[model samples]
Target: MEIFMETPTAANGGNPGKKKRSWKKLLLWLFLLILLFSLVFHFTSSLLFRKTEAGHLKFITPTVAQFRHEIAVRGDISSSENQDIKCRVRSTGGVMITWVVDEGTEVKEGDTIAVLDNSTLIDSLDAQQIKVAQSEAEVKAAENNLLTAKIAKEEYENGSYKVNLQKLVSAQIKAKEERDRLAEYLQHSKILYEKGFVTQSQLEADIFSLKQAELTLRAAELDIYVLKEYTHNKQTNNYESDIKTADANLSSKKSVHLQNETKLKDIQQQIEYCTVKSPSDGKVLYVNETNRFGSSEFLVCQGAMVRERQTFLRLPNSNKLQVTADIHEGKISYVKVGQSVQVHTDATGDKIIQGTVIKVDENPQPTNHWMGNVKEYRVTIRLENPEGVLPGMTAETKILVEESQDEKLMIPTHSVFEHGGKYYCIEKKPDGTLTPITVELGHSNDKMVIVTSGGLTEKTQLVAAAFENRELISLPELAAGETSSPTIRPKNEEISGDFNGENSNSSSPQAGMKPDGEMGSDGPKFGAGEMGQNTGMPGEIPAGMNGMRPGGPRPGGLRPGGMRPGGPRPEMDKMEQNGEMSAGMGENGFPPGMDGMTPDGPKPGMGMRPGRPRP
Candidate 1:
């Protein structure tokens, strides 16, 4: 096979146009490389720096040194005591509203607000007055008639005595005459029968005449007695009946008089109310049945039909404006008398007004359809300065119930950790170690917390959060048991024991054995003048105990000892005086009287009774 050599074309090499095209392609590739590098850098940085931890992270600070209580502003408004005013009476009469005062007019006590057309009422009142007059006259006439009837009854009772006496006297005289005639006739008839001058029939007739005379006399006497009894009983009863009739007439007249008086008073009051006077010193608010007044005029216009007792116009005291804010039932507890408040009127950048809660209504306001589904209490706040504020102005208010100062020490609530049912703060050690410290806390306003105890002084540095992606060390595991040492590391160079700076490895001294073989003294045994350098017994007795020996058993039987007579045994004593023995030769080798001695009693040579023999 034969190979042919190819020549370089203008587009591939030395030609200017071909060189520019090649350079353009190279520039484009360089740009693409740069874009790719930027993309890789952005992706890697985002992945590395993203916040992926679940717990909250915050800068550690003493709760007492940061955060301030925020203050709130309150608002006030005015509302009508009478929400709705309706016509109280139905009438089509021409209601002429009399203008007692014009708009923007200031009225005083008893000033007239307006007068409705009172012609109808006046006419009715006049008619009532005439009827009252007529009733009064009739009552007077009835009273006079009752008086006349009482006089006539008294006269009739007095005349009854005379008529009864005359009847009784006449009946007695007639009865006596008839009895005498009957006796005379009976004697004559007997004489005639003895002489035989008369016939038997005549004698019988005479006897019959005597018997009739007797009967007549008896009848006359009975008539007199009956007349006297009837006069005494029936006449007295008639007098009593007449007196009762007089009383009934008097009562009837009195009742009529009372009714007339009551009607008169009522009519007078209705006439006075017709004038439509202002109840307070205020500007006339408006006229009913017409809107021509500028919210300050009270007038009764012609052809306006007004009813009885209708509110023709309103008079509101605009100078002293009050606000009634509806506090929701849930927040009513926070709203009390004398709480500080600020009021803002509308959204109009107006100056905020200050006020105090004056009164809180005990009962909540009745809910209505207009009010959303919420219970509210009407709280009245009296504004101190109500110069420019008008009634019915919309306002927004915020009540400030609580507040605090700034720069108060505050810590993030979550930074505090709990373990073993105790609160602790995680503090970082110089060697990068972490440990927990118990702390007492104080007032916390939800967002921040306060540490009240546990040696947490102001500005002490603490761990705000646990190390990222690092596991927390458990305190229980580190401590091992309840008697284990504390984790505090002292800064002093002299402290050279366990974490609690206690000698954990040293063996306890044997019973009755001091560091020195013999009892050197009642104090620490050291070379002469070496007290400061030696780690002597922490609470050792003074030297030269004289008759007593060091590390010896107490005079009291097997009693643990301390500086105070009855105090707890020194912790160091347990380690230093272990297995010590008693020196006295009593029972159980205890000192004499030791069996009766209490644990708190002084030992034999404990300076009691200075001259006594030492144990």
Candidate 2:
């Protein structure tokens, strides 16, 4: 019994040792399996991450942020209301300024502002004075002639006409008396003859004397009639005509004299106008113009000819200030009347002046052809407090177009690209795989764009720029029946074909797909003149196809221009020989058939193949 108990003790002790060893072995195997699994998992994850990041050098995590939509433009400060002092001279060819007040000089009303050349006015005044004197002499002569005509008329009517009538009446009375005496004498002689005391000759003489007296009486009566009727009328008519002619001459002379006097007054007034006077009290500001080459277009110096009504100086109100800026046509839609602006002037350094947009011009500023076709609209902003700000200072304006009241998801403008007329961005998956996801966009500025929707979150990571990594990315497949490609033609362009499915008869299913299809980095492919199949990603035009020339249909039902998608056609040789083909050369500077053989010898790496001859 004692021997058996000792043996049992030994067996129990061995069992404990073996159990400890077995437990240790199982733990070690578990550790080794865990280590191996961990290594495999790490290697897989690293490979996936590297593959996703192979083409991308930049990445961004979407975040909720605020971006201000604003437009910045540089402009000049000016006064809202300006009292322009214009040139008011009316001289021909404009008047030349002999003297002018210096710019920025403050003056009171009625002060002499400028003086013009008055020499011409002085000469005109002298000539006008001579004309006035001559007209005055003519007027005096007309007055004397009028008086003499009136006196002559009165004298002829009262003195000459009355005296002639009286003389005729007296002659008639004497002739009547003589006729009566002779009649009486004849009667006495007849009585004496009856008594036979007188001889017959004496009676005859008495009768003849009576007859002569009667004839004398008739002549006197006729003279009286002629003097009273015909002679008086003729004399009155002559006097009246003389009076009318003299009156008309006097009126004409007076009119001429008045005209000369008016001219003389005008000349004197112009002489006074030669000196310009200030209409109001203000500081003078010259209205000079600067040309494109930084030279003054209109200088307000002495001896410069000023045009009529041209604004040569201005009197601006310093209290009312404003800024004028030009907004480009692309961003002008954001600007409106009454919008707020922040102005920073060079003179007021670091100080921001608050202003309001008071005016927006309807028309664009005129631009030169060499300046490019960029239309800019003028915007006027009135300063609220114009203290310490002067006119003509340079200023930069920041116009606040829009601002976000709530934080929203946003990304850089370059992170999004257009595909199939929809915007997309490369999204990084949790497993480190990249995929293109559609995104809805809202208002954008120069730096950032607002993401309206697309299931994006704050933790979403996107490629910083999509176009820069488009080659390494796998683009989305096109929808059913969707064909998108560009057309290519030769330099002469006699034939045409559309890579989008028009006039295409290629048997290959992948022709004209991606832009750089088949013609990879090794240059263009010349595959027995057969229509090539594109091996590049779909939906994007590649750089290789950009240099393709047009060709007509050929054997095996090639597309309209025999020219395939991958490269040019063999018919190009015949076209080149006939001078009908003038396509642009590739980087090697020679066509396929004309390679290597040039007037200057063989080109680098472009020597003719061993079996081919130069065309």
Candidate 3:
């Protein structure tokens, strides 16, 4: 840049005074030019470097506005009272879904929403039937045994006992008759002997005969008493024990029968559970299909095995509308329960929904690992007149965290800058020079910021942008004290599918059933209702034989009750200690690191040796 100056030649040659005046005038113009050049150069350098401010700076005056401080968040609409349809059937290995209602279908209460393949359950039921029959047979056998025992006891007590008593009575009668006959014979012999014709030897012989008969009768009487006291009592005791044993067996069989019946009933109930129905009337929301690790699978469909109690569907109560939004960690503190909010969504075509913040979750939502450790709180908003909204519609919300009612001086959002914990504005002075003015800031919006302090007025012209020689110290200062994340605008649900992508989000059973043949790698590894390692012969129990539990009652054999317990061995203390080192062990100790062996047996609990306790 060059300056134009007319020569003072005429005045210079005329007089010394005039020349001096002319030179003074020239020096004054030169000083002014130098100052202007300096200012221009500074601004030029700033422009070249694309620094804070340059010659292109514009100025504006502050205006008064209603200042409302709000935090903006994005989230989805959902039913406040969602009724989840969960998988109710329980199995050690899961159950395969046969058919399910199409996602997002409207249905009434008690609608048959889904059906599961119950072939396995039916097979189990058949096995249960067999078990019940076997148990019943065992119960019947035990009952028969008990009845036989009772009958035997009765017969022995009455018929056999009476017969034995009658036989004994007959023997006693015979013995008595013999004794009487012998006595009579003896009397006759005595009378004969007493007479002259009778002999004394004969009478003596008759008396001895009579004594023998009496002793024989006494023996018979003793036998009867012994039979009644010992044999009959012993028989009765035996019958009682037999009956007790039979009764116990019957009770055990009855318990088994009850268990079998219960198992049958359970299988029946599970079969019923196979047919899933919606409990309430609403639109059906299929749960997101997930893998075993709980990661969402794009391929969830029929034949997917849902675990017990896994959510399959959601019946949203659309009449009661609410939204769940994710508020960033930095701004979550501004949100609290019972604050007013404004919601916007594309579905409503910019129609704003009035609402209130019903909940500000203290805990953070599960975030993608790539999102760093930053927590995003789940803020709940209850909307007024949200009649047509549905679940999964993304909502743009602004929570009114703070407000200042009085008219406050505000300016465009870009005009303010901060430095060293202070806000500043470049005020254009009347003298045509700009200087920095410190200002206290308050509420702000997307387009304007409120100025609370500093001597700024309504008519003061402030630099619209920071210029050369005036740069903010921090990144936050340049953005008018707002921390905004870089984003793509008008985010919709389709674009947010990858949200929380870095985090594995497993879906519920019914969320993403795509078609008949689709499934995850870990979901229903079996295809087309084919079971893995569970296919078995009909009427055969799936897990065990004769309804015996698997993995116990026998471990060495593949089937239950197929193996016996291992035999006993000598107690550790009773084992004889070998003097020599064990086979494959060095001569020192059994472990080949010995200090105790001296051509003698190993000490107790020492290094292991043959016939010795392990060290």
Q: Name the best candidate (by lDDT).
A: 2
Return model 3's CA RMSD, one decimal: 27.8
lDDT by residue (tens digit), candidate 1, 412-521: 54556443335666655555445667775554433455565677655555666533312344454211011111121111111122222122211112112222212311
Question: Which residue pairs does candidate 3 place in steric collision?
Answer: 53-467, 53-468, 192-198, 286-511, 287-510, 287-511, 288-511, 294-506, 312-510
lDDT of 3 by residue, 1-615 (tens): 899965656666545587789899999999999999999999897656533343456779999867777777788888898899888898777778889888779998889999988998888898999999999999999999999999999999889988998898889889999999999988788777777566777777888989999998998898799889998899999999999999999999999999999989999998999998789889988777645345686333698878898887789888888988887655576778999999998878868889998988988887555554445789889998796677868888888877777778887766775443356677777865567787776655555777778999999988776433354222333211122111111111011112222222212221122111122111221211111234334323322221121232211123322222222323321333443332334342234334345364444433434445332
**Model 2 vs. true fold: TM:** 0.58
lDDT of 1: 0.52
How close is every model to the real structure, measured as TM-score?
0.41, 0.58, 0.62
**CA lDDT, candidate 3, residue 406:** 76
- List the candidate 3 regions with Cα displacement exceeding 4 Å: 1-63, 289-300, 363-368, 412-440, 453-615
Which candidate do you rate higher for lDDT, 2 or 3?
2
What are the lDDT figures for the candidates, one per model? 0.52, 0.71, 0.67
- What are the per-model C-alpha RMSD values against the true structure? 27.3, 20.1, 27.8
Q: Which stretches of candidate 2 lie over 4 Å from their true place?
A: 1-67, 75-80, 176-221, 289-296, 320-324, 365-374, 391-394, 408-442, 445-615
The Cα RMSD in angstroms, rounded to one decimal, for candidate 2 relative to the true structure is 20.1
Model 1 lDDT at residue 165? 68
After the best TM-score superposition of candidate 3, give how far the Cα of residue 48 lies from its true spot, in angstroms.
9.9
Which tens-of-lDDT digit does each residue in 241-303 have in candidate 2?
988999999999999999999999988887777788888888787788767555677889899
